[model samples]
Target: MPQANWFPRFRLFLLGVLCVVPSSSLFAQEQPGQFVLTPGVVVDRSANRIFVVEPSDALATVALQSNTGEVLWKNESATRPLSISAGHSLMSLGSVDANRLGVLVLDGDTGKVRAESPLNIPPEAATLAAPLGEGRLDATAVIRGQRGLLRWNYTPPVTKQGLPPGTLSGLPNAELIPEVAQPQPALNDNPGGFVEIDLETGEQSVVDPAAAPNFAPANDAPEQPLLPEIPGPKYLSADGRHVMARERTKGESHRFMMLVFDKQSGEAIGKFPSNVSYVPFYVDEGRIVLQKEEFAEAIDGQLVKQPRQLQALDLNSGEVIWRQPIAEMKFRGPPPP
Candidate 1:
């Protein structure tokens, strides 16, 4: 008699348990309002808050809520909230008003407007990219109508160490560590170069894509074979240290994999099986959170139970820290008439 393949079967059984388990303690928190969380939502784990852009009709509101779903503050204006990014004690909002492009900086703790500026880009430009590192407020926007990139800088409130005071104040043990310079990332390898503008000086320059630094491995390091090219959307970590993408397995259309790579060297770090469909929510503190859905047939032919799951994965080890059914966290629109 052949030995049974117990390990594979056990793995599948464990996955099923993770998907069906309803006793997870993480879901005990109160549920927030029926705000539809769009793709541009931003999470600040250090401040224990989540910022979401809620659009109604002509105007949009940006609301900040605690991790447990308590509404902190809501800022509403004439422009629609395009994108939001937070760092240190400040948060920047990229917005669009009719044909005008605007950027607003707010105090992260109080949601008060600290500075407001306008970008000199085409009105049709819709995409916005903002800074992610601490005390950084540089932003970029893609001009779809003119095929150009718009970039601008903002001077964030800094302390003696050159970092935002809120960042150091929030630390539990701030006095124990010495001040140091932030790590500078090599020029990104993305093919799209951008135009840089100094908000303070009103100067602009075009950056050539070819001049970007190449991240190839050093000659002294052992040669590492490149990973097979994977076709899927790519998501880069906020700090530019890691990249993650969804890839389909060869010869198996149904099997999907999540591959993580080192952004500096372009080397594959780890890969793991993943749900065929999932939404990447946020990446912070070396972990990535994703929302996945699983459907089950119901006895009533017209009704199907779709369970939403929240999963946290450690970026370095590709290990699942926790998997919980979070149906309450799923976005809910207004009730049917």
Candidate 2:
């Protein structure tokens, strides 16, 4: 049997982690020499806005104009975005900070705080608050917000208890018992349990955080003869007329690639390999923005793989509007550590 993939790798297995693509009015992915975007990016098509969360330290949330890539607002009130809500006008997130602890909502257009609710969990709740190693990106916290409800992960304070006297404690040679070593867990691997809280009420409950959220839209689209094969998490476009997801392929070290299909016609519009990690992606106005691998040198084996490049590809015209390295991209907040 295949062992289960964990958080990130595990979430990538969700197969339903879909995003909607715009069917009309495409725009430039980003203004050259402007903002840099990472995974967990969200696009609000209705408002013509783009949202990005700094994955590393300084966990700030930023809003940019989708067309011009202009900075609208950036703040730390929301750490990790769970999903876009209330018709793409609002974004829900897991909020954790020095004094505040709870669920946070932001205005999609302006990065302004629309509402804040206290979570029964700690500000350090969830792996999002967990310290990231030198280079880690998977946020295992079971963060999800919908219909005024929120779910996130938090580490509980460890309690100490003495073991009860073993029946064999007095057995002969019991004093010679061996001390078995306890296995140490890898950081950023476990997601732990999620604390489900009602945004309207202070009510809270713990939910299983072992698995990723299945946001895969209904597979109502008739299967087309050449529909792009989606072997991983599938993202459905906003209009529910298109679908996008990753498929494994050969010819590259990263076996997984991206594919988009017309849900109605079953025709493949786009298919290619990219930053294959289970990073968040968004499709809007006939354009898809994703992380593209870059290279410092072509013949010298200088590929910028550590922090890849963000690229926008027009699905309608098959044109690449913009592309930039993430580490070199400009922003208004503290440097991404």
* lDDT string, candidate 1, 77-163, tens digits: 312222223242222333424233355545545666555555553211111111111122223332121122333343322222347
- What TM-score, to 2 decimals, does candidate 2 have? 0.50
- Specify the highest-lDDT model's number: 2
Tens digits of per-residue lDDT, candidate 2, 123-230, equal 222222232221122222122234332333333322224345574477799768754343333344333334554433435566554543432222322232334354
| Cα lDDT for residue 92, candidate 1 | 32
On TM-score, the leading prediction is: 2
TM per candidate:
0.35, 0.50
Poorest lDDT segment (10 consecutive residues) of candidate 1: 17-26
Candidate 1 versus the native: TM-score?
A: 0.35
Could you tell me which 10 consecutive residues in candidate 2 have the lowest summed lDDT?
16-25
